[model samples]
Target: MESPRGRRQKRRKTFFLPLGTSDGSYKPRQRAGHARSRQTGICQVLKRPESATNTVKTITGRLKNARTNPSPKIECWIPEKNPSNTGLVILPGGGYGGLAEHEGKGYAEYFCRAGIACFVVSYRLGTQGFRHPAMLEDALSAICAVRSAAHDFSVNPGRVGIMGSSAGGHLAAHTLVAWGQYESDVPLRPDFGILCYPVIVSQGPHAHRGSIINLAGNDASPELLEDLSHEKHVTSRTPPCFIWHTWEDSGVPVENSLIFASALKKHGIPFELHIYQKGGHGMGLNAPFNWGAECLRWMSGITGHKTA
Candidate 1:
């Protein structure tokens, strides 16, 4: 069944946000919000890929099915210093179903201020039905779109990176692992990967089955679960990754990070791994002088970009 909010978010045909002004929230936050909105508006919607997909309509009559909604809109923020340079594409984590405002909007400026253009993706989620590759399709399309328009956006075609947290992290891993699957295809390869408390183990005792279940649905079979588990698909080609996870994560086992890092190292892929002693999960950009500072420094080291 469709909830009200999900229905509203899936309405994609229109350009501008549906009528009525945004209900005011924390004003300082709103000012930050406005800057981010203006930045996203500069982004032009990219073309959908030629991949074939199959799907059915939702109860709300919108295209909630995976294959039907292949294309994702692209929004960018070109840095003043490197106006026409390629940079990171930030895929905000929303458990494979939604994009959170703080991660997708408020957080984009951090990248824009840095010297890279930010591609905040508005991908279709599983509100309609569980589907494999729906998220991947959207992500791959974003990568290709950015790379194709690298000159127009001032993006460094060869230096583009992709980062995400949690479910978004899982998608990033999958995109990396499946990089070579499409032969004779445009280079959808991301130069590097950043996974924060990523859920890579999808099955087994240490697996994060909820993420897979939520993505594949209640009737998800074991075979489907195994297929999506990034650990199962790791190969030598998986991009160098920088990742971190809290030891106290209750949602996903810390093993998810360990196993992924292990796979990355085993495959000879360059990677940096960190396990914070404290801090619970979903601490989105929550740095209180202790954990956040270290995390920022780690990101700077890996991406070669300075941090605050």
Candidate 2:
């Protein structure tokens, strides 16, 4: 498949690789609030090679899911300066069925250029027989892994945060709200959060059904749906957040970010929300109305680090 438009930026060192061709085909389902169908976008057949290895240069680590088919991997992109004070773990949104490489590498390189170390996580999806907890676990694990290895990557463990787009935003939000609730090998909570057009409500008017289905399956119970609806879980303890959405985003409704931001506001959590008049779903880090700089500036304000 050809790379998405605007992905041809000057490259940085990376261990992240494109997920190979799909054997299964995807078809778009027409439904209300469906945003974009799975068939029309990048959701292709799954055919990941078993021989893929982690990179030593960029601190790529495979969080093997021995119980599943597509093993989760963490691709780190450390800034050239090394020992940066802050870092980010990125979760690319693909409706929880597939990973979007553009969101992964493209966003990582964008942040890396700003002097913030980043790790793009390709986690196990529900289509591979995994479910909600697996994606959440992989996200938390990626944060822990980054924090544990902060010294090696020249990052401050205390300054690490998580960022995600669309469905991946749901995972990042879950991580922020429920970090200490789960058992993990290292520190679980991120210092802050950056969610771009996230899937927040699992069962509301703004709910993203495909993302919900991919994470919890088509027959998810009411109880499961309630549990995964992250807006209801926000508390004063949740980390500060930076959220943005496009007003014209037909895929993941802009209301997803609005409702989540409202929840954050209700809980009195520090946050910054941006709703741009243009740009639609899955734009990655494309230029012309890209909000990456604004996000980075907000990050710098919180972390007390100058933008690279």
Candidate 3:
């Protein structure tokens, strides 16, 4: 992913996070603008998914460090309040190659004001794109990492959740199924999922090619397709979810969330689905949609948090 500054951006030399310090050393994001002083250099370079023994189940996918050296984990946003026994990890959308910063960091800031700690997961983007599983690995590892360090992070690990849009939304869905089905060391599930105009069912132009291609890998095997599709793998206990989409979207079809909602409905799992007449895909939570009131109200109802 090209940095926003690109070459013109003054490159800050690697100095904050030690190259090989084990995980759990970094502190959670604090309210106000204070950032962890230790990891001051490069942002957290994805590392191999850490092994977990009996962590709670939450969100799916896995993330690994791409670089041989570990960089300091960067806190893109500051929390205005403390963790409210519940926290959220955000995976912003970017078609598996790059992350939409506006979607990721800007969205996480909402959790802060609402008194929920948020970890904006910057998973490894595909350089020309990595395998489908690579993004998944990073996503899952991030959730587990937060869960694994719940106490240190100032909240209850049991109530962690994940949210995202577009490609990220799809990963949030895929991760739950992966945890229940895979043998990965990281915990494979999320307690709750909030998908904003997710790209769940991929069969149209709005269908995320990067998502499909990444999940399928180069050969494009049938088994891989089956594995990455979250709708097909949904179980009775796939966790509570809150989903929303707009009919106006030309990118990822609304049917993606519709199918996911149908599956959730069939499974009798607790969920809330809000199909808006406006607000196209990837509107960034607080966009100029008239239904902002409805969306926020719905989110508060589902998560039981107040986001003002």
Candidate 4:
């Protein structure tokens, strides 16, 4: 087999191609108070199945219909020089209500500067009346899209990983464990995971109630709750992970990361866990600690990339 660096050298320029769209005219809404960063190069909206559209009543007693629902999309970014053979799919946290541009676009820019290709996923949200498998489906789809087109993005297919913050971290952990349960043409399992202050418990004192309720509804079943609690789902098949959380994260308690890391240990999965002494929730790339640098170092070790 050719070396991964050799594959990077043959990479073509990246392009925005709709993965599962028909008309190819879907445009995601811009969340108020969050500006789109210039670092996000181009976006491609992936279409969901017709069955994905179901009228659901949100917590606010308002009806959300397919006409108003936004499909999942991916914003792509590729480095201009000496790109590494690694790709990352970012899932930003919004309590399942919105996407955090800083976690999405800001992370993309930071990682791209280190010669890593990035894809920021705008996944279906609970506030938008999506739930459970919908968010999971979108996450898997984004991974498949990036891996399937790894050459175009100048990354090795086997080096693609998933990263999420807060609720997005929950989704990333869920994807890591539950990917084998879903069927897909291309491999849907991420090679690794990077979780930042994720919400891991779905039905406990440590659970972020807003995220649990938004994702599974107030009437979620016991079995569903257990399933959504990603810590309960970790198996040997789950990939290696790099998890970080602040002890001062009041939003999603530090115990969430602890429990998940414990599960990883139980399954004999190699992982790196970082607990910062300070920093509140949603700090993104602006945390007092240099988590980005640490994560880059971890990526280099995993991918064996000298320049990562």
Candidate 5:
């Protein structure tokens, strides 16, 4: 099958709304605000859907990213169809300094075409003065909002999963391992995790230095680095995972994914892992070497979907 970008079809209208505020009665409003960044950017709220559709539609909106004013927001991408009742929330990779825009929606639309609901999340970047807990908080809020608003998005809350690449993968892994430990009235853990060429460690040459520096700060303590070193923290509580990476990826190193997979095995958490010989790093939803089909196939076993 051709990728969404390769196929020609009539584009459908998309919507953007604040996650908690939309209740099927939302009306589109023209408001100027930043788009998930401390830097000023205009983002408009879209009208809520009266009901779900079979075509491609989206709901993009802001979710709280920080505790203070002038903070960033999380952008949630709601797919048009939910026949599978499965939702996947995505976090794009940018080494904690920025977000990979194509990695966000490109993968979301790919899954949306497979009858799965997807939300592309944009968290606060460290370059904007946001730190460890900020990104994790925004990610947790996105998961909570997706679950709380599952009806509005036409997805099964229990089937919700999270996917990420590179640094974003680190955050996704962080959430899966630490969410249960977080004290919140809302459940924040994802049913599963998908990591693509992820940065899984905070120490060693295989780790991405920029990512660790951006997240833990330059003068980070040994305890802090160990805490963020996700491979050491994995346990049985961590959700099942799907991890993939290219063997020649010198930027982040394939060992990052290998070590994490090893920990997952140690805890006996069921997982699927893949390593490609080519396609270096940061190949976001590109053809010929993409993992979307395999990922969907793996998720099908977990969600009881007919197609993978």
Candidate 6:
């Protein structure tokens, strides 16, 4: 793909490399466009190799029923100039049922312009009869995929981070707190996190009920709910986070951000919290706020790059 100014910016569609298997005998499947950079506008769909199915089961204890949805994949966006060594995996929010385009591609475009390599994850969703660990598995796989392919994307493996909006924020948080439970040769924890008006607690007056129901179902047990409530699981190991929420976001209450920030504080984790008094849910990069700019500054501190 090319920008309107006639600058070359290539966007590629590719499947994540299969993660390590139980026996540790899996070899990465090779493809013609595995790391090709081109100006072609047509997106070539790369089939998920069979080895990845084993990887899914290894990560989440079960594979997503293939009949319910297509396998999860990521859309790559590399900057046209001075690409930063930083890479970010973006998870878009749709209450665990759908993906918000603005939050996915829109955020990707914004960060790619600032020289960050971006991957927009089309992870498994709950509305498709999928549930908790399915989404969590995909999130972990994305982090591993990016770090494993850091050389191909011109990114520093240690600088890779995860960003999500709304329910996607919950997914990011879940992956952050729950990473220690999953074993992987590749690091599953993000170096940092950017959560925009995330759905935090799974059971509370402030919880996003639709997200909880879709993720855990009405018959979910209290133990599962407590585990999914990310705030309750934060520890010193959790990565530094950048969180922002609007006081007017009724869809997912601002308290979600508040309590999570409070948890991060309790653990003495480095973080930045921004509370805007305007905008509702799913505003993406459209709101008349400088949260994006502030995030760039924070990211600069993390990456030691002048992203602004």
Compare the candidates by lDDT and give the number of the best one. 6
Q: Runs in model 2 with CA error above 4 Å?
A: 1-71, 82-84
Taking the tens digit of each residue's C-alpha lDDT, what string does model 1 give over 1-308? 76554342232222211111111111111111112222111233332222211111111111223254456765565554553243676777778767766665545666566555677776667765647767776776667656544544445566677877788788888888876654212366787887877878777787666667667777878787777888778887777888888888888778999998988878898887888877776666773324335544555654455542
Q: Compared with the true structure, what per-residue lDDT tens digits does model 4 show for residues 1-308?
A: 76554443342222332222112122333223322332212233232322321111111101122133234567766675534477788999999889999988899888877887778888888888888778887787677666544544556777788999999999999889988876544567788999999999998789999999889999999999988999888999999999999999899999999999999999999999999989999999999989988988898888765554
* Model 4 misplaced stretches (Cα beyond 4 Å): 1-71
The CA lDDT of each predicted structure is: 0.61, 0.72, 0.61, 0.75, 0.72, 0.75
Best by TM-score: 6
Candidate 6 residues 81-187, lDDT tens each? Answer: 52347878899999998999999989988988887888888888778888877788788766766665555556677788899999999999987787777654656
**Model 5 misplaced regions, further than 4 Å:** 1-77
Clashes of 2: 2
lDDT against true structure, model 1: 0.61
Candidate 1 or 5, higher TM-score? 5
For model 5, what is the error of residue 142's alpha carbon versus the real structure, in angstroms, after optimal superposition? Answer: 0.5
Q: Write the per-residue lDDT of candidate 3 for residues 42-156, one digit (tens) a residue.
A: 2322322223111122222223432222111323222334533566778888777678977777776666666667778766665554566666666666665565545434545
Which residue runs does candidate 6 get wrong by more than 4 Å? 1-71
List TM-scores for all candidates, in order: 0.72, 0.77, 0.71, 0.78, 0.78, 0.80
Stretches off by above 4 angstroms in model 3 are 1-80, 182-188, 202-206, 290-308
| Candidates 2 and 4, the one with greater TM-score | 4
TM-score of 6: 0.80
Clashing pairs in 5: 16-46, 16-60
Superposition TM-score, candidate 3 onto the true structure: 0.71
